[model samples]
Target: MAVSTASPTGSFGPPPPTTAGAIVVEGLRKRYGSDGPEAVKGIDFSVAQGEIFGLLGPNGAGKTTTIGVITTRVRPTGGRVLVDGLDVTQDQVAVKLRLAIVPQRPNLDRSLSALENLTFHAAYFGFSRKARRERALELLEQVGLAGREDDRVDQYSGGMAQRLIIARALIHRPQILILDEPTTGLDPQSRLFLWDTMRDLQSRGTTLILTTHDMAEADQLCDRIAIVDHGEVIALDTPRGLRKLLPSEQGVEVVVVAAGDAGTGTGDPLEAVRSTPGVERADVVAEAEGRTTVRAYGAVDAGDLVDRLKRAGLELVELRQLEGSLEDVFVHLTGRELR
Candidate 1:
């Protein structure tokens, strides 16, 4: 295990009364549409101290359902949610104050400028006008949105709008922050920028729980990740530990060099690669324009397989071994690509 790391723990605000272990959920369950169809069917997990917890899954995998229940946005069919040791259902008001959620969709007021968006959010949290302004400015600057503070949300780019949403979430300095698919559909640059912002927030002792289908995002940010698939957590561990479960597979992706729509190469490369040494499986295949490419699963050091292909004279023009990643484990467990 690569022993995950996160924000500082063990320091508190003055005595035995300060917050500890920001969020906790036990035997969480929720279902919709009746007895036959279940959204979340009895899952249990915990976020410790100041660590970043990742809730990962495909679309409609009970991630949003679990989050909604924990954040008090929706009532659960069963199971109790607690924040800072307070039952969410019983101490709804207190729990609400200590939590902040950045929704997957933008809810910013179009009429308000970026700064005004944040200010209005703080006002909803009941911050005084002056305090709201101070907090809004500080948060905007922290998220790299200070320069465009006066621009209306409609005028802002997708990245900019996302940044503003984060600032809005922080308006009250909540004990825990929840981000639901914070960077989906973002350009690469914007995605990286948001990741940096997430790191900054973690460094400042903000415990974060994020829901993302992006393996890279979960691997890079989560202290530990729980892989959700079809309404169940298929696996849970540190990113490295999760990959170790699949034994560090060397993924092979080939882009063929071809001249025409039809050509022959050993009948079928997919079948050939499946029989190669150290190969666990080979699933992805595409044939177009005299080219045949495949995505294969194999343990590290599959050079022998390459040598075998060379001996068989399979015109292998391109080959690169991708290092094992969380995506590999996800595929191994769920039998589907994360994307």
Candidate 2:
């Protein structure tokens, strides 16, 4: 079966491909306990080949359950999953060969060296000793871990370990890579490094299915994102497309630069904002002692709001139209942000 998905721009491509990067899921449902509630309530979406598909959701959403079912770590009570047209349930053995999963946590054997870890992983897939060794070194170099190839896994930093995990997932060059919160605990530099690596992999025709709470990552990488919540698919679209769905009455925030007892926004800044042509409401934020922040939510232009503030005897330091991110979109759509 073919999966017809809308692009990030909310458009369609030529009809679904037959052999190329195609994934299909229909009425996908999975429940943990026989008598308990179902974790996944018949959700469905597909990943295109060479495309980065991001799975996003709040805590307790069925994101993990959906991944587990597709990867065959858990069985679906009723549904269909096909990777490259291979039925996940019927051909579990073969599907495993074509799929690689990067779990949310670092599961590397602490005692094993980087080289040893990849070597062991490769051998598990039946690679010859020499082949495993060569491939391990090659992948280490690819992920910029060549210098640390001999380092013990336990000593590897969060980012370094993530790279190794990604490289290990690619040792066999699976058609699809599933990443669950791959960069959760990493520093800024490490997160950026992983982003680069992901781009490189996509260039080589590797389909990527990833999950992350980081809005920037999803916006930068994912061709489309599936916003899951409470065991259901709430929204699925490109990051930009999702942003467009925000309420027409977008809000603008302004920081006050008033002088002489500016602590309580004593001046007329609030009046100036409310008087703006498009501004529906505005007020000073008392969260900070010296900071006077004004936030307005309505069909108002941020530029106009800024202009109004300047004319009202208030200096414009910085002004921005805040259209909350994917997290905000999730919260607006699902009534909660993904943890």
lDDT of 2 by residue, 1-339 (tens): 111122223221122234664577789888778788888998989888889999888777888888887898888998888988888889887778778889999899899999999999888877778877877897888778888888999998788888899888877777777889988998988888878777877786778898887878898899999988888888899987887678843777778776543444436778878987876666676435555777877877777777666666566666777666766686688774335
Evaluate candidate 1 by giving its C-alpha RMSD to the native, one decimal: 8.2
TM-score of 2: 0.74
**What TM-score does candidate 1 reach?**
0.72
Candidate 2 residue spans exceeding 4 A from truth: 1-18, 249-323, 336-339
Error of 2 at 94 (Å): 1.6
Q: Model 2: which residue pairs collide?
A: 21-49, 58-338, 249-298
Worst 10 residues of 2 by lDDT: 1-10
**TM-scores for every predicted model:** 0.72, 0.74
lDDT (0 to 1) per candidate: 0.74, 0.78
RMSD per model, one decimal: 8.2, 8.2
